[model samples]
Target: MNLEDYGEGTLASAPLDVLEDYFAAHGWQSERNGDEEIVAAVKGSWTQYELRAVWRAEDRVLQFLALPDVRVPEDKRQLVYETFGLINEQLWLGHFEMWAASSMILFRHAALLDSASPAGLTLQQAETLIEAALDECERFYPVFQFVLWGDKTPQEAIAAALVDTAGEA
Candidate 1:
């Protein structure tokens, strides 16, 4: 029910439980969607995104996906794609993609958890990955908005996003 219940241990064997507890510990409302999936919603300053953590037993990896509420219109597909290319390169951990068939955009990352490896999952690692995905979503959300609704060119949107704001501080 909580992080305290699960003492520090190798998560290679119980990644799902570890992840569920981790999300719960962080006060994120989550529920098991099926045997190997947990769906959670995280709110950002711009919007809320649904984060899904799915354990692929066959591959021994935990795949996390975040889908923002923004949808790319057919006409804006090229602009959105161009914007994602720039954003994806800047990402160190995960990548963003536009699913044309679904007309949805998602941020995705994976953590390998080979049971035989000495390195096991840690709360810090999981947290870092999840946060990275969310941070990417938050950072690029406005760019997508600019392309989708603000009638801004992809180049313009990216330039606006990359403007240095530390000086404003």
Candidate 2:
């Protein structure tokens, strides 16, 4: 279905379709996973990142996840864990997590829709979340590289990744 189908003020009850359509409209490749999930992929400088959106009908929440291609080495798990705390605190939306079993790191964000209606679940909101997730991934990826390969401390890595824009404004 197209985005225009859900006009302003109308409840976007189909969370999965809405997410899929929104991503597809932006030229991102997307596909359904089983019944409740849609996975979309976008290319980045380092690698391709997979963004997954899962619709929880019962809870009325759409969960967005972006999995970077980088995997934390077993030896550097502790360092990465510590770095995640620093990164998460600076974030205004979503958080980073590591899956021990798979040795993979992921960025996740979620939006809760009104159970009675989709008053706040607009296409613009969905796009904003996806854009934020991707931006966060791009920004922090180098920090992970520093911890894993450059043997830098979390503080050093964060400091290196941060860009000072005090005078630009």
Please, what are the lDDT tens digits per residue for candidate 2 over residues 43-113?
A: 98777999998877677788989999989888999999999999999999999999889999999989887
Which has the greatest TM-score?
A: 2
The TM-scores, one per candidate, come to 0.86, 0.87
Q: What range of 10 consecutive residues in model 2 has the weakest lDDT sum?
A: 4-13
Residue-by-residue lDDT tens digits, candidate 1, 57-112:
76888888999998888898988888888788888999999777899999999998
The parts of candidate 2 lying over 4 Å away from their true place are 1-13, 118-120, 165-169
Look at candidate 2 and tell me the lDDT of residue 69.
Answer: 95
Q: Indicate which candidate wins on lDDT.
A: 2
